[model samples]
Target: MSDASTPEERLAALDLAVPEVATPVASYVPAVRSGDHVFTSGQLPMRYGELLLTGKVGAQVGLEEAQRCAQQCALNAIAAVRSVIGDLTRVRRVVKVVVFVASTPDFTGQPQVANGASELFGQAFGDAGVHARSAVGVPVLPLDAPVEVELVVEVD
Candidate 1:
């Protein structure tokens, strides 16, 4: 993709489609904007309202699979951001990202898995997608998803 391309076009160049905003699982909304920032709730690797994979990484799942799951989580997060702002081009910066990896007792590669989301942001937003991030290993996540991610972005 070229610098002239928009984020949406960059996504298509990667053969990734930004799905419709997922239905909220509970009481909270997908995202909310405050001041110049928009915060998105945790996004599971769900497509068409169903989880793509459900298991604990390093146990029922493997590292590579978990990485793909993380990518999907980021894709979903992007969709959430668009659902609020109408266009991803409105984003001037991706300020922060948090990823939760459901893992067994021995998994120590949460950062690599989380890079799945981070790298995609870099691809879609270039320097703008560079951001602070946290990758945490957890006992479980909602709906037994292998990975979950959330983001905070600065919009135009």
Candidate 2:
């Protein structure tokens, strides 16, 4: 468990900040709340309106860079969730996470890359952040981003 008192504090301890929610490139909203849960759309590894990394993992992008991209995507997902909930403390549990990695056909490190997002959540929310997850390798992602992430969280 994190020593920090709150999710924001834990993220700060990791040298990360919840970035502003990125404008959806399409017609879809960033996130929506239904009942006690919030579901976030796929979030790219964009920082300041630009993709943090491009190309497939095991090609132009490496494993570590892809992992960083996953972390950025998770950060964006958090921002999306907060946009709907207004308060991060309202989160009860991180229900699920889905990570997509653009990678070469032979590449097989998707799970390790997903750990970047998972670890960040664990640090930020402690036990509440532990959740089921899926890591998938894809031919490409929107904007050629190295990674993308989506989240589902139960809220108070």
Candidate 3:
């Protein structure tokens, strides 16, 4: 129940802000815009320069924690998007999202974990947040983070 109208205000209503774009841990840039679309590199659950959690889901990490990590990853992806577009309001649609969860081989809840990111997008962009998504389980991710997320967005 937020009266907030803009994306930044909506984030603030949740006690969050589009954080500073995370420093790339490797050679790749955070985001790139080509024509009307922006593609973001994979983003981990980093905060204040440290990962929120480091472990494989279902082994050392639980579902709830993994979901939280996923949310952070999406937030980082949002920051990456902002870096390129300079304005969240410019986003016309979130075209696609890919969530990667580092998990035990037995883990089959990748989709549930990805809901963390999807829900955040809904809160951030409302109807435009609806998008195709793929949730994949992996043995490991960069920096050993529990979750990573990337986005493809169409902008005005």
For candidate 2, give the lDDT: 0.93
lDDT of each: 0.93, 0.93, 0.93
Ranking the candidates on TM-score from highest down gives: 1, 2, 3
How close is each model in CA RMSD to the real structure?
A: 0.8, 1.2, 1.3
Per-residue lDDT of candidate 3, residues 1-156 (tens digit)? 343487888888899888899999999999999999999999999998999999999999999999999899889999999999888989999999999999999999999999999999989998889999999999999989999999999999
TM-score, candidate 1, is 0.97
Q: For every model shown, what is its TM-score relative to the native structure?
A: 0.97, 0.97, 0.97
Q: The CA-based lDDT of model 3 is what?
A: 0.93
**Which sections of candidate 3 miss by over 4 Å?**
1-4
Give model 2's clash tally.
Answer: 0
Off by over 4 Å in 1: none
lDDT for each residue of candidate 2 in 56-143, tens digit (9 for 90 to 100): 9999999999889999999999999999999898899999999999999999999999998999888888999999999999999998
